[model samples]
Target: MKIFSENITVPASAIDENSHVNNITYLKWCIDVAEKHWLSTAPKQFQESHFWVVLEHTISYKNPSFEGEELRVETWVTLAEGVKSERSYKITRISDNKVLVNAKTVWCYVELESQRPARITEEIRALFL
Candidate 1:
């Protein structure tokens, strides 16, 4: 699978009372990167037929990130099963290469109109794999 990586700069607004990036913000970063990765691989028809929904997420915070620090967020598909898939993320201090956070999320394919589970296509699977 292809892992998508993007650089992010910590902004003053992202800081919390403790003067570090908020824990929830890290999860948002993970979600954003995962969406970007999906868009890159999915076709326009896929967007019209279905949407992916997060079923579960597990996040681990290993270190703190401060404002003005440069970070890299990476995401990839770890597994694809029947109508569900697992995505993994890593946030790291770019210069030092220290992983600040890691997350794994389970997502389900859903038919947009019915809002029910739907099977994924081989074309979609190939794009992700």
Candidate 2:
């Protein structure tokens, strides 16, 4: 599978009371990277007609990240079938290359206007390939 990666700097706003990156912040980064990957790889027409919605997310916190830390966020589509695709994510602290979070999210394709689940066409799947 092709992997999409983005570098993110841990911001002060992302910190929780514990002084580390918050759980919700990690999820936001996952979703942001997924959208960015799709937008950059998929055809313009496909992007215009379809959008994705998260169906589920499974995240494992392996370590903590602090403000000013540079992290690498990587993601790839693992499964694409019917109307759903599973995307995986890994966030690593750049300083030590230690993984801070590992996650997988299930997303369903939907029509832009109708907002109803839409089938994954061959053309769409080919974009990921």
| Predicted model with the maximum lDDT | 2
> Residues 6-25, candidate 1, lDDT per residue (tens digit)?
99999998899999999999
Off by over 4 Å in 1: none
lDDT on C-alpha atoms for all candidate structures: 0.92, 0.94
Model 2, stretches more than 4 Å misplaced?
Answer: none
Per-model TM values vs. the true structure? 0.96, 0.96
Count clashing residue pairs per candidate.
Answer: 0, 0
Which window of 10 residues has the lowest lDDT sum in candidate 2?
A: 120-129
lDDT, model 2 = 0.94
